[model samples]
Target: MDDVAGIFARESPYLERYVQLGIASGRVLSVSFPDAPDEDAEVDHELLDRIFDYLSGVEDDFSDVEIALTVPTDQRRALDRVREIPYGDQINVETLARMTSGIDHTDEDDLNTVRTALDQNPAPLLIPDHRVRDGPSAAPPAIEQKLRSLEGL
Candidate 1:
């Protein structure tokens, strides 16, 4: 099983990208996003346990699946907030490195720092990007041909 475990915040967006790439490559088996509530708020152990129970339900399907977590660079406060939680300990640098690798055209120094941090602490943090990419259009001629055919019909 190539599954990765990380905080929900860090893993969500990267999961989206990984799923997209998996769909493109036809290698994705399944994806998991374990829910984590705000830690600074009052703790509801029962609710948290229930969430874990739900995650356990799907654990079998992803027996051999690769797990990835999304870590946001902007949520330092959130990371600090969850430091006491059990899953919080699982947050590490490898997950962050994987997430960083997904980012397009990042500076080498920044990437290296993130890698080094992962090496040192081995925790994942979430980094969200509001920027959008305007990727190239797919199947342009096919789309045009379909439009022309409809007009002719």
Candidate 2:
């Protein structure tokens, strides 16, 4: 399990996204989008099975899992705020920025700052960065829409 982490992917005519999970010491260490595998992810079959099972339902939330955010100091607070967003709920970037303002002194306007932090989020599904949006900041727009649709948002 140390050498091999589970990789899970889902696709539909309207949406496609890949989720890679690296676990160490029972905690999720790293999560990112890797190039799609050419073949099935059969190396870590059991882990991928569980992840796929959880993803099958729209209401399933990963908040119970411990996720690490190894991001820049300036972006850490904003990312944390994103994690607090309850499942099935979405918030505007302006609101997220205002909530994270106390983290550091910066120009009062935090829309750009918050958007930048979220744009660079490494763990999209785990952190639910798609919930933080004003207009089209959500990457791979179709996937974001699909995630929201799944959550019934």
Candidate 3:
């Protein structure tokens, strides 16, 4: 298994905040809110810039940034649909469950699958899990709301 062997931190567009990324094999594996910047960690300048851009309301949907996720097949399917949600747009959980799981109607089990997939999203901003209305993400509520506000949602 690949471990998060690289760490990078940068000043976030969010006031008085810094964002840290855990990277491995040239793909970002996680994002976190840290109180201070790390000057010693290796830097992936390009990816950090993209994250800053996204936080700055630059309107890039993060399609260019690569993220690594390990999840069950059902969860992967739901996340794939979540990734396609554009910046500043939102989708209801019911609709997303149908679109991703291919259920003819809104089923509780399917909705739970989508919810669980979102709740377990390893990378939030890169995957845009918050774009799904009432969607749960690993990101803190403040951060998710901040991201949504940044996107003008």
Best by TM-score: 3
Poorest stretch of ten by lDDT in candidate 2 = 6-15
> What is the clash tally of candidate 1?
23
Clashes of each: 23, 0, 0
Relative to the unseen true structure, what is the Cα RMSD of model 2?
Answer: 4.0
Residue 78 of candidate 3: its Cα lDDT? Answer: 84
Q: How accurate locally, in lDDT, is each candidate?
A: 0.27, 0.62, 0.77
TM-score of every model versus the real structure: 0.20, 0.69, 0.85
TM-score ranking of the models: 3, 2, 1
Q: Model 1: runs farther than 4 Å from truth?
A: 1-44, 58-104, 116-153
Q: What are the runs in model 3 whose C-alpha is more than 4 Å off?
A: 1-5, 13-15, 36-40, 102-105
Return model 3's CA RMSD, one decimal.
3.2
CA RMSD of each candidate after superposition: 18.3, 4.0, 3.2
Model 2 TM: 0.69
Which candidate would rank higher by lDDT, 1 or 2?
Answer: 2
Tens digit per residue, CA lDDT, model 2, 66-152: 655677765778878888888778888767766784643356545556767788776677778877656343346666777677677
State which candidate, 1 or 3, has the greater lDDT. Answer: 3
| Model 1 accuracy (lDDT, Cα) | 0.27
